[model samples]
Target: MRLESVVPLIPAELVAALDHSCGIRTDTDLLFFGSSLDIIKKLPLGTVTLSDLEKFTELVAEQASVPGHRGDEILAGSRRISEKHSQASCGVKELDDLVGGFGDSRVFEISGAKGSGKTALALQIVIQGLLADADSCALWIDTSGDFSAEKTAQLVRHFDLAVSDKLLERLQVSLGFNIEAVHDVLDALRNSLSSSRTVGPAVQWIVIDSITPLLLPSLSAVSSQGHAMMTTFMRRLRELAQTFGITIMVINGTSAAAPFNQSSAFASTNRKPALGPSFTFMTDCTLWLSKTKDMPDSEGPFSVHVAEVFRSRATRSRIWCTFQIRHGVLSSTIPDL
Candidate 1:
């Protein structure tokens, strides 16, 4: 009845196939994990089929309970009942109303050029999550070196939220200078997730403050491999989001484009997000952040930043909202046009 005796009874090909698909690095990975073997024990002894093993693998993955209901549960609901859209806000009313805040187990891609307040908004999200709940946690993968602790502190105080060690400690920051370092951080997260216990405040949010800089350097040199790596990284991110019910926001730099407000229709501008089509398809929502021409000192002192929901799975309505940084915090205004 022990796992060692049961392991030999299972076919090697089934194990190999599972390893390839599940990224099981070693044999120990297949045998270990406290609950995994428990599922396998239900199968008939000394006669394990591939179907049974596959079922066991699926049961193991289900350990990471998603925030939403399963497909079967959704289908079983009354036909007259409408699907509910649950979202978590970032403490910004206008922003929340626009994109329905950040949904659970979804990826939000914020595309903008440099100096377009991407980092500012990202910090605000972390602050919001911490402020929303005392135990809420967030992770910042600073590949672009744009995150600032001092500024975050200023915003935390600006909101009049308690600036205690516990609140500050809730937000974890990892500065990955190179792609290898980024991979290392992801590997650590994966390992941490394998355990049944909660790891590091049950991380609710993960922000990659601009993923372009890291991949852009090598993308030209090894286009195929670079694209593949980027895709894999995003896939792993998606898995993490689904498994941990974390909201992922990846900062993407956009190519410059001439301003075109010719028609009311949402036109696709030359300003494309980094990672091209592959990334667009993978993202659940894409928000383009752009800056209009600077206003004169008389018109307005601060520069205006517009956030357009160019692509979204939740709603088709094209939303255009404006926000400005005041006292190191972003204040979102009503939609303009």
Candidate 2:
């Protein structure tokens, strides 16, 4: 029998089985699943019931799934079974020991007041990824217009990339000031990826140096509508992260309203940074950077920024580490606190 003809005859139980096994969500429409009729031909006749088919259709319409074991519960059970099985990444040994490592398909939000080493960290990742020779390319969306060509050149020189000046030429740098422009650049990037099987090195990382400014103008009202818009924007970012299999690093600034205990914290609060409750929740990982004041005589005048990893899918509990930018390379000075 032709697959197309059998589509209508397939039982609901068979459809449900296909959906669960194929990771098809319940909301998938007939038109979408109809294309997969070929795969439905393998089911035996009379094995599935019309009632089961109806249930499957209903589930698809409602975008509901059969309840089963929760993922978190499974992980907790496994962790209990094997105490040494931690999900942390292979970050720099010392740093990774504390906050774990960056995870694949995750959005990491780094927020701090100005001059808080956010850009430095972003640059560091770009250089490190290049050094790792993961065939990795980086997309740096300079939202603050602070990305420096000279600085990038300095880092390239400092690390001494292995690629010839010609292949190194493939490393593209895009600069954008407004959100629309940034979106346009991203669209171009997506198109490039679709058009060519091997267009430059496989892009593995994307950094938006300071996403706050791009979102600030639209979030002035902070109403439900505004929040919805913000959510949509973040969803797009998440989509890009997944589609390209790239790690997304967004630099965010804190708002003035966040409560502060010390004079320094109060001063930081006055900077009028971005504010949105969902910002913290939507991110897969969040790192808060704050300046350390009243350092001992041994420490320099430069504000010491400490990194705290909060809300990560794969990270360590060792929070609190110091980072410094030397010779244009951002390096961790002390291990975990």
CA lDDT scores, all candidates in order = 0.65, 0.58
Give the per-residue lDDT digits (tens) of candidate 2, residues 1-337: 1112124445445556564554332232232444334434534565455566555455443432323678897566545523321332322444445545553556788777766777777766656655565466778888766778777776677666554343345355677786666767777777676675655476666788778777677665534544544565576677666556666888898766545422232333343235466676777777766655423435333345566664566664325566644454555554432
Candidate 1 clash pair list: none
Best by TM-score: 1
Instruction: Return the lDDT, model 1, position 322.
Output: 77
lDDT of each residue in 1-337, candidate 1, tens digit only: 1112224445555555544444443223443433545534543455455567666555434432334667876444422122111436666677766776775567889887766777778778777767766766788999867677887777887775556556778888999877667767776766575768754566778888768877676565434655655655676687777666678898888754447332113465546677665677778888777766444455345567777776787655467777776555777643552
Predicted structure 1, TM vs. truth:
0.69
Candidate 2: C-alpha lDDT: 0.58
Residue 4 error for model 1, in Å?
22
